[model samples]
Target: MNTIDEALGAVVAAGDLAGAVGLVWRGGAAQVAAVGWRDMEAGLPMHRDSLFRIASMSKPIVSAAAMTMLQERRFALEDPISRVAPEFLAMRVLRDPDGPLDDTTPADRQITFEDLLTHRAGLTQAGFHSGPIDAAHREALGPDLDSPLSPDAWISGLASLPLVGQPGASFTYGRSTDLLGLLLARMEGATLEEVLRHRVFEPLGMSDTGFSVPPDKRHRRAGLYGFDMTGKLKKIDAPPGGVALPERPGDMEFASGGAGLWSTADDYLAFARMFVDPSVKLLSPETLALMTTNRLTDPQRLGAEMFGMPTFGTGSGFGLGVSVVLDPATAQVMRGKGGVGTVGWPGAYGGWWQADPTNGSVAILLMHNMLELEQLTAGYGLGGYGAIMEFHALATA
Candidate 1:
C-alpha cells in the first residue's frame, strides 16, 4: 500500500504542482497530507490552513443556502422568480449575433426558484455561448464573473439579455447560482456574502472560506497561475473580490456564485462534511438530496476534445454546479469505482472535492497553481482519479 503522504509528496517534488493539500476523515480517524509551498516564489511551506480561490466550488454552497430557505417556506420551488426579481419577467431568446431581435418567443416557462436551485434557469454568462450574446454579455455584465458589479447591476445585466435556451429546458452551465445569490439577497435583505456567512459558513465552522484573500493572509495565499499547452505554470496577478464571512477580514466587490470563493483544504473538507450531516446549517436532507440529483433535463453530449479532458467520454450529464458521471465505462476515468451515483465538481483552477454518499466517503484535493492543460492529468484529471481510488481504499482498509 502506498502511504498517502508519499503520494502527495511525489506530486510536488516532481514540480508537477507548486503545492497540494489532501484530507480524508472517516470511522474515527483522520489523515491529511499537504506537500509543497503555498507561495513558490518565497519557498513558503504549504500548511493545512493555507487558503485557495476555489472557483465554482462556491455554487453548491450557495445552492445549500437557498435550499434552507426552501425548506423554511421562504419561497416555493415552483414559484416564478420574476416575483422576486421582476427583471426576469420579459425574457427573450437569442437567435444569433445579428439574427432577428424583434422576432422572439417567451421562455418555455417562467424561470422558477427550483430552476435556479437546480441550475435549470434560462440565464447565462459571457463566453458560454458565442455570438451577439457574447458581445452583449461582456458589454452588459462586464468581465468574467469577477467584475465589480453591484448585485443590482449584475442581475439587471443578466435580465436584460436573451436566454440561450428556455427555462428548465436543458443543461447549460452559467448563471443560475448567481441568480440564487441574488434571490437570497433580496429575500434576506443582505448581501450574498452576508447571507452565506449567516446561513452556511459560520454554522459549518468553516472559518476561512471567503471571496477575497486579505493583505495579512495574502502571504499564505497560493499563487494563481495560468498554464500553457505544455503544462507550464505562469503566475497571473491575483484577482480581487470581497471575502465571504471571513473569521479574518477581507473585502471584495464581486460575489459570483459561479466562481469565486477562497478556501483552505481544511475549510472545504468541513464544508463537504455538511453533506454527511447538516446539523447546524441551511439545507435539509431532502434539499441536499435535491442538490445531488441529476438536475439537467437536456444535457448536451460533449466530446473530450471540447474540454481537453481525456478521462470524460460521451455520456456525462451536468448536475447543479457539478459534473455527474453517468457511465464509467464510457467516461474513461482511470481509477476506482465511480458509478452513476457519484456526484462531484472541479474548479477551473485546480481545486476538486467529491463525496460519494453511496460509499460514505469524502475526498478533498487542493492545488495552488495552474500549469499546462495536461497538468489537469495531475491536478484535476489524475488527481480526481487518484483520490477516488485512494479514498475507496482508505475507507475499506
Candidate 2:
C-alpha cells in the first residue's frame, strides 16, 4: 500500500470502489494510476481518459471563467447581478431558513458577482433546509445536475424563491453558481455551453470537458456506481436527491455551472495546474491571487455547515470558488490537508483535487461514488470517501 496503485487496488479489491483514476503531479512530472473497473458488471476497465461527471468540481472552472470576464473589464465584483439579470432586483429573504416562505423580509442588498462566486448570495439547496423552502426548491429547480427548464425559465423560477440569508452575510452553498452560469451566458448572448467552451475550455485545452459527451466519446464514459444498504458495490442509474442523472437529456438546454461538467483526470489536472504554476497563464497573477485568497470571515467560516457539519472548521477557509487550507494539521479530509495555500473543491460524485503552491504539487482522484441521500445519512455508503482519503494521502506522499 506504499504506492497509489496498491492503495487504491486494495479499495477496489475490498469492494469499496468500482474503479478510479488517480494522478499526482509534482516537480515537473506526474505519476498516474488507473485501478479497478469502469463498469464491473460489464467488465470494462478504467482508463486515464475515462470520462466522469465531475459534479460540483465544475465550480472552480466556471469561477475562473467569471474572473476572466473581470480581467477584461466586463464587470466589477461589486456590481449587482441584477445588472445583467434584472429578475433578481426585487428579491425577498425568508424570515427563518426553515420557516414558511411567506414569512419574509426584503433582501438587504442586491446579490453581486462576488456573492455568487463566494456563495454568500443567500441562496441555498433543498437539502440544507427542512421546511417549505426545501419542497419549494425541488419543485422550482428540479435537479442539481441537469435541469429540464431553459436557462431563462430556470432563472425566473430561482428568482421567484426567497433568499435563505442576507446578501454577503454568510455562506449558503446552493444554486449561486448555476445562476452565475446563466448570467454569464446572458452577458455573452450565448448558451452557457458556448460561453464555457469558448472562454474556459478552449483556451485551457480542455477538449474533453463539456456539459455533454458527444456520441463518439460516449464509450469512454464511466458508469455511475453506488453502495447498496449492505455496503456492496452496485451500479446505479438515478440516485436519490437528484444530485445526478444516469444520462443527461439530449435536449437539455440548462448547463449546471456548479455541478455539471464531464472531465477526465488529466484534463482536470491541466485546469488545476493553472493555480499552482504561473507559467500556465490562464489568469493574471493579481487576479489569481484574489481568486485563491480566503474571503470568509471568522464568524462566517465557523457558522457555515454542509451535511450538518461545520464546513471550514478552524483549519480552512472559503475562497472565491475553492476552499483554502489555513492549517493542514487540523484541516478535515473533506476539505483536504496540505500547505497553508493549498486549494481544492471536491465534487459530490467522489472527484477530488488540490493544488499546493508551497510544494508546487497537484493531486486528483476521479471516480463515480454516487450515493443516495438516505444512504449517506444512514452511513451506509461512505467507503468511497475512505478510498478517496487513501488515494489522496498516498498521492501526495
Candidate 3:
C-alpha cells in the first residue's frame, strides 16, 4: 500500500467509516476533502461545513471561554468557586468507595475557578437520585448540564458526589468545565451558550456551534457515528434529551461544558487560529501563560498514578484544560510538528487539534466517525494523524 495514499485512502475505505471529512489548514490557507457518504441511507455527501460531533475537542474551546472570563475579571482563576456557586463552600469527599449516602466532610480547599477549568475540581456526575444533593439538583436543575440550574443547586449537586480523586491531584477528565459553564451562567448573568456565543464564537466567527443542531441546518449537521470494538459503524443520531424539536436546540439538554456541543471544521479552526496569534487572545497573555504551564507539578510520579501511562509530551504535561509540551525528548512520536510550546485538546466523539507557537500554526482534524487510527501509524498510538503529519513534514522539507 502506498503509505501516504493508504493513510488517506484508509480513512475513506474503512468499512466502519460510513462518512469521513478531513481538513488541513496551515499558513493561512485551508483545504477540505471528504470521502464516502455522510449518510449512506440518505445519500448525503460530506461537505466542508459538515457539522461533527467534535466531542472532547469541545473542551479546549469551552476552557478558553472560561479563561476569557478571567481576562475580563469576571472571576479569578484561584477564586473559590463558592463565591458564585455557594453549594460548594461545604463540599465533601467520599470516604468509602461504597458507603453511607450522607457521610461527608468539608472540602480541605474550596474548589477554585482554576480547579474547574483544569478538571482538578473533584466533581462527578454521580448520585443523581440517592442523596439530598442529587435530589436538589434534579429538582432544581432538571438533571441537565445544558439547562439552567441555580448556582447553589449546581454546586451542591457536585459537592454531594464523590470526587474521582482529591481535587488538583490527577487528570480525571470529567465534568469540571461543565461546572465552569454553570458558574459562567451564574456570574455573567448569561447561559453557557450565550457566554460562548457573545465572547468566543462571535469573535472567532464560529456561526454553527451550539448545544444542538437546528432543523434547517440539519443538512449541515454531520451524522453522528460510533464504531464498536469490532469496527462496525452505527449511526448515533438520537438527540440527548427526550425532547424532540424541529430545529437543533442549543438549550435542549444540560449544557455539558465537559462534552456537550457541536461544531464544524471552519468554525473550530478559527478558534484554533487565536491560539496561534494571542494578540487576539480572549484571555490575558499572563493568564494564558499560567494556564499553559504544566500543572503536572509531580511529573512522572503523579502522572503514572493518574493515567494508565504517563502521557507526557516533549517535556510536556497536563495544564488547566489542555496538554502543554515541555520537552521534545519526552515526545513519543519523534517526527511530528509541535516542538516545545504547543498546547491543545481532542474531543472524544472524533477530532484532534493542536496549536504550536513553535510552528506558528494550528492543525485541526475534524471527523465524527471512529476507526483504529493507529493503523496508519507505524504501530504508534498517534493514530492516523501521525502518518499525515510526517507526510506533510516531508513534503514541506
Q: What TM-score against the true fold does each predicted structure earn?
A: 0.82, 0.97, 0.80
Off by over 4 Å in 3: 1-6, 96-105, 126-155, 228-230, 239-253, 278-281, 299-315, 332-337, 370-397
In order of TM-score, best first, we have: 2, 1, 3
Q: Regarding lDDT, does 1 or 2 come out ahead?
A: 2
The superposed Cα distance between candidate 3 and the true structure at residue 67, in angstroms, equals: 1.5
Q: Which runs of model 2 end up more than 4 angstroms from their true locations?
A: none
Which scores better on TM-score, 2 or 3? 2
lDDT of 1 at 378: 48
Q: How many residue pairs clash in each candidate?
A: 7, 0, 17
- lDDT digits (tens) for residues 2-39 of candidate 1: 47767667666655567777777554355787777776
Residue 354 in model 2: shift from native, Å?
A: 0.3
TM-score of 3: 0.80
In terms of TM-score, which candidate is strongest? 2
Candidate 1 — which pairs collide? 97-132, 211-244, 231-372, 241-252, 242-251, 242-252, 377-382
User: lDDT by residue for model 3 over 1-397, one digit each (tens)?
Assistant: 3343345456556554555455555677765656556776688877778887776677777788887777778888779988887766766665542445466555677778777776667654433224444444445445443445445555565655655446666555556877787778778777778888988899888999987777788777767555444445656544333212224444353477666678887888788777667556566778778777777565432463222344553366767678776665564332123667677776644466677777666666566544333332223223334434543443223
**Which residue pairs clash in candidate 2?**
none
